[model samples]
Target: MHALSELRQARRFVIKVGSALLVQQGKPRVEWLASLAAEIADLRKASEVIVVSSGAIALGAAKLGLAKGGRGSLADAQAAASVGQVELARLWSDALGHHGITAAQMLVTIGDLEERRRYLNASATLARLLEAGAVPVVNENDSVATEEIRFGDNDRLAARVAQAAGAEAVLLLSDVDGLYDRDPREAGATLIERVEGVTPEVMAMASGASASGLGSGGMLAKLQAARIAERAGIALAIVNGTYVSPIARALDGPVGTLFVPQGDASARKAWLGGRLAPAGVLTVDAGCAVALEKGASLLAAGITEIEGDFARGDLVAIHGPKGERLGQGLVEYTAAECRSIRGLKQDRQADRLGYAPRAAVVHRDHMVRT
Candidate 1:
């Protein structure tokens, strides 16, 4: 009955459960998980739900007999994940089966979400599962992820998955209830009921982990997740796991920290923001360069040279004469077309390439300043 009515209207949502929620008193709480699964099943009646869960490493650590403060190193954590992932999925499957729902396990690494093709493929797979009436359970492929790009926290990973899947909202369930004006543990801290924007003041209230728990993320990580969701034009909410129907309640406007999207961005923009790397570089003439710098569309006549082999629609770096990267954008033509039209006059581009998609090599709307 919590007032998150807006959230309930969303047809698709991503729910992230932190490790601390899964492990209580240093042990896996199967009962709590069963309750969570039941709530998810209830939600599934009205919407497609994708669960992004963390706890494989924590469960693995317990199984491997690693005592508190005994997790050796990154290698040890990876090893634990390998051992616990199977068990984690099995437990979820068993719990979900009680509700007559099947859960599909999807383990992915940073590379999978960062690359455009892989990102689309991953999104397609999740969509297929939802269409087939199966819940897609996602987790980072901790066994192979390095520290640099590893979504050390599933909160951010869940946001990324939600964005990729075109989900309308993301629900992050953790130990804490929601964001606060200051540390809740402090004497006078107060809960922040709604967050319209992730401002500097809000960021200043973020704090690191306090409890000796299995989770890697804290409030700061949750805020970062909200930022990602906002940028992708998805609503976000942070709630306490103790609420058995937190997901449903959040959608109903219950007491939680809600983050409304700033505005809706095009799918292409989302893809660009999610791009891992640019395939090549496009250098334009001074006039074209100036136009681009001033937020003008990239014209075919502005091309002086194209570096690297890239196809149409591939993300490329736009550079000026002095090798300064003006921005990154989706290329309109293939490397061959670029070469054919290199140094051609604006009116002569069509004659050189036989046709033109647009006057510019990269459109301003398709570009993002680096």
Candidate 2:
């Protein structure tokens, strides 16, 4: 099992800030937010950081004088989220601005991450923001996301974002120091330093609700998030965020429970190969088949046929002329666009399409050989 020190070696990270740590009695914790911003500023000197924040509903509920923690009707919760999103974004912008850091807000729903095209778009957007030296503040679209189709807690949402961003690790800073063998409120409960995997026994240790009653996630939700990280070969840790500079403190010592990564496949490959329902199929000629064998990208000149109505970034099965399945990959062009440039060389593709298409219909980096 790895220790908290592993965080020091990671180049990119996704940090989840729960409602309990950011909101108190229905108001934002300005001082704590400032402390967190300072730590993030320091961390950004050597690494890229992404924050998954959850406090809009809590903050909004307080302002609207509705049931706290979104315990009331779904409509009420949505209304509170509408009011809180503005405040949440402003708070993060103000806090990060103090340290000369630009804060970018990204709101998404579960469908955004689950759908291939939207997933790629979201990932690319985040990459662009990070490349420009800005920290992305991601949150679930609670205001419009229905309760039946929403991620009620931010923990699982953070894990999905980590996967999308190809982050090295995830840090879930919450109210508790770490996972305990039992409810920490119990006298005999003890903290577990390292978790090799999220086993049934380990999962049993989690509780349902947070102590602060301001957030929907608890130890159980965190464990679920850890499972996602473990499958994606990303390290994850749970630590207390109540203290000053908690992220810095955790990285300097063994202050949290580290969940070791167990995935044997690359995160991208795992995601690409795991799609059970491919959106379309592309049948390439023998020339393309030969090039693919040499690990070359799938060029437009090699494509013989395109089937199914699919958009760019959608998963498409690649087939050789002999009707044998070559593999599956994300396409770079829509079906209509592919038809306009199929079997055309580089210059011909540009002439026919009236624009230069990407170098490859399916880039080698986005392909998974079966």
Candidate 3:
């Protein structure tokens, strides 16, 4: 099969366009946006597609005529984002309209994706857009987002979108072509083609931000995005956005850095790991902890203590004896019930709680082993 076919066969995908790709000469690149819309139009015929876009701040800055080399404070940045987001959506709508595709703009904050209910709601909205044959163009809600809670970069936002949308792959398009052994401009630096896994050595090769005065994210951010995709069992590709058909070319495997998925974790597990909020903690013994790490379920006997009050089905963090977080899982019983049955066997749960819900406090299927 053709390399591009791999991506073509994907049921869903999230494509991220960097600030550099969206802006040129301190303004939105109309032609680039049109080209990307055209590409998405083609891909939509074969698969569902969602776009995680950047450049709101850059566009806003240009529109507001912010002085160059001025003090770039958070207030300035936020002001710019407010101005630019309108233009960003307007450009997207006009560009995609050329191909008879409607574009729907969706602005999100980190809090939305980190919370389970909000995450599910966001996912549902995007899925509905896909079902309606419309492209959902997502961006960070920069106008009100504080630095502490900001996604920091669209690369990470794209990964979260991929996870939330149950996408099979995430394509991160940026100024650079792909990862290299070192800075490509430096003497003897070579491009690293395919990475089966992201090792410390590979991460060490990453450099800081680019010389181009476009965006904050660099090679390291893309690497971090890959790690997020990896944990979600979603493939990731980093390619140059300068090319006219960059997305098409990367899907065809012309040349790019591909980050392989770690394992086949279900969408629920991915959601649990990538999107859920932990309401409490479950401390376990060493043997039980190892079992949980090895992908085993959490039983009543293994649970030493229930640290917080939470309802049944609420997300909880599983901790080891030393208080290290082993992983997060949906608890089978209420915190009160769990506490009452601590150190009891599976059969004893019924007697303690008046009735047993399941054989384990957290079934393996409901748990995401870290």
Candidate 4:
């Protein structure tokens, strides 16, 4: 349908670019990229921007004359990424530099986002880069990324990055204008403008990978990304990047499928704590319950017993000594670790466990008081 008002009002957001739009016929489209950079420069004055770009492997392989066209072995792909990353970064730097804008390259792997400590650190880095007035151009570390750990496409990565970066919206710019009932060129295919929710029916409309060799994601990946972004209370727009100044146009017009969130950030946090069933239950003493009421974390010393087997990062219900449920939160330590440290002095946790963990069993940020 039309551009969401939230898209235009976003003070911070992500713009994802795929390889097909960045390159054509094994050659970099410098002029198109320069124009896009100009738009980014203009957007930066009033709002913060983070770019998730994909093109290193394609441009890199083409430069080295490696497979004539498609991907080679994992080793060959990583080799291409190692070489192309340099050129890709340089080109982005030069283009943005022309507009007096600074572009910083931050290559990340799946581990960086999946691990709790690394996730916080990576998010802080991106926040700092935006605060310093430099646009962070994020790319997956393809060189060493195995299939098991790989994001597979930049679309899902962009969605995850949007959540971590605290971005209000995510703009996915690809060759397609928006999502359709089917392939647009085919008869009876109709453009679906706004996706209020990503349902089984909505997912059924999605297709496979892109026909273009330069790009990896198709509509399916973008829809999958929209689901992730929606859960994090971020809106995602799937827009066409085939034109110059795509970002601004997408924000100003009916350019793609806009998936709006059903709730705000606080609501999303509430959902995280209670929406999913608790993996396990945790029993804490009275003092810990009081501390939780005062907005403190669940420390090991405060917990008297662990009720079930739950891995780290799993949601757990917190209970008072009398078996009264206090609330739920994400646990930082596994059940086995908690078993060893339960009732132990908080300060002596490292000595007992042989390694230090987070000071709190569950941080306030991940805990919700009910």
Candidate 5:
């Protein structure tokens, strides 16, 4: 399959720009960004695009006259990120602005993506931004991120962002065009055009950490990212960003190594099924169980019991009348609110809950069948 073409055909995709591509000599590459922005403008005509960029710390280090290669104390790097994030956002705004596109900046920590409630919120924000025809430029919350709470590199972060946004593909723009059998510097080294899976052999072929001081990750990190994308049923590609119109070229030619997806659960379902532990349980009546078997959402009228304390957006176990676990889903109401509206018909729910009730206590789309 033509991997890059798949990205072009995707309804939505993410593009990751490494610090090495965005920053040179501690300065943002304005012309390169403009070129990329132009390509993104064309892609946006057919697909929604999100950008995960790295450069804030690098730019900040330069501005603060810190040592090169991001060599500094954690406090210094954080200080640099604080100063550089504004500049990074401005650069993206100006680049995309030239094409009449609006850029929205989003900063996220590991916890933001790991926590169920925060994950839902982040997903909603990304969906809203895309629906509004705005390109969301995401980055690690470097300013506030300690080493323990950080992604350590943008590659994995981009993959997570793609999964969160329900993107079909991710394009990792790096200094190298693609994965090589051996270091490209060595003779006879060949670029692997297509990767079916990130197996142990593939990981072994990868070399040490990033030689480019501006970036933190290397081929290993990218492979880790591809694995994440693979499980989320999202294709990922690693391509050279040094070339002009990289996305356009990748779409039309063999310009990168594409990692195939494993066709597993959707991102939301994956999280609902495995990533999170259920915060509570909702016991539904016999009729409700039958409705669920027919693919109906869990409504308050069907819910007979609520156990444990769970807030809105928390994952909850669904039990049938026989107390058998049916599935788990994200609950739309807090435990207290759910208790107030439990067993109420749609028309009477608002009276007990003191607000217009949602159609489902747990939406079918948000549920994962065991």
Candidate 6:
């Protein structure tokens, strides 16, 4: 268990801003956005900040004169997002600009993180933006993401962003102050300060139901986000967004529930080794086998053969020369594309496919040895 004060010393961090704090009556909360921008600007003086914000669909729905019921079909949400994303980006830019800081919009889909090439590209883009002293405001591409492929909620997206950016922690600023023994709306429900063990009881505290009518997020989503952070070796703090300079205040007071990072190495390895069933198989040459042992990305030139009808981003088994299982990783190319690039040099990828894809068939970061 950790406190928000621990975040003050974190050099790299992600902040998740939910729709509850961002939209009101179908419009952007200008005052709060301004304050949030100021807070982010101040934090940038000492740390690198990445904001994973959730409000496009809500803001879009508001402008479209949708009900506040928070239970719309996927198509309705998508249409709202299509019409509202422009305004959302504009408002964020205007708000941050007031503090002499530039805001960059990054609309990511679930596939963006699942695919090895896109994952690397996104990470590189974020790093470049941060290095140039700009805050990246990340949001899901709700306009095009279908129900099954969606990240589901921004809470999960925030955790993924933290992992991709290699952030030390994620501060989830929501409507409520923190996690409670029961529903906060219930009488005599006390807030839990520091969460160390994500036991069954702790998980049971967060309901699967939505928290507020304005947003799709709930305590369960935050808990899921915490689990992702724990596996990624990063802390997650969930706090209320009612106060002025909430980020600064969160770092100084007992205002939120903090989940400490735990079981990162073992959990990640276990997930890769046991939980995932290989969707495809890649048999590598002897030299490639040796290189993989030394921790190298799986390149097309090294793959002797490909098996299975797997698509890009699907987990694939890596086999050594003697047919021994070496490891498993997400494939960067579909099975069809893999066959075309077999034994081809990295630079020749574009020539073979008529368009350049990633060089590695499987990136090292997504690999796990069993």
Return the top candidate by TM-score: 3
What's the lDDT for residue 346 in model 4? 72
Question: What TM-score, computed on C-alpha atoms, does each candidate reach?
Answer: 0.76, 0.73, 0.77, 0.74, 0.73, 0.74
Cα lDDT tens digits for candidate 3, 13-118: 8999988788886777787778788898898887888989988888888878875411187888889889889999998889888999898999999888876789
Q: List, residue by residue over 1-370, the lDDT tens digit for candidate 5.
A: 3466767789898999999888889988888999999999998989999999999999988898888544578888888899899999999999999999999999998777868679889999999999999999999988888876678888988988888899989999989989999998999999999999888789888875796877779998899888778877889999988887888777778688999987688656765553325789999999999899998999999999999998998889999888887888889999999999988899998889888899799999998654
Cα RMSD, model 4: 8.4
- Model with the higher lDDT, candidate 2 or 6: 2
> Which lDDT value does model 3 have at 38?
88
- Between the candidate structures 5 and 6, which one is better when assessed by lDDT? 5
Question: What's model 4's lDDT at 310?
Answer: 95
Residue 40 deviation, candidate 4, in Å?
A: 0.6
List the global CA lDDT of all models.
Answer: 0.80, 0.87, 0.82, 0.82, 0.87, 0.82
Candidate 3 residue pairs in backbone clash = none
Give model 5 RMSD, 1 decimal: 9.3
* TM-score, prediction 6: 0.74
Clashing pairs in model 6, backbone N/Cα/C closer than 3 A: 26-62
Model 6 gets an lDDT of 0.82
Q: Give the per-residue Cα lDDT of candidate 2 at 93.
A: 98
> Which window of ten consecutive residues has the lowest lDDT sum in model 5?
268-277
lDDT of 4 by residue, 1-370 (tens): 1355458678898999999999787688998999899988887877899999998888888888889443667777888888888988998999999988889999999777755567778889999999898999999998888766687789988987887789988899888888898877799998898988888689889887685766668889898788777767788998888898887677677567899775554633624532324678889999988989899989899888888889998879999999876778899999999988998887788887888767788888888754
User: Can you tell me which runs of candidate 1 are displaced by over 4 Å?
Assistant: 1-3, 67-71, 210-212, 248-253, 274-370
Residue pairs whose backbone atoms clash in candidate 4: 1-193
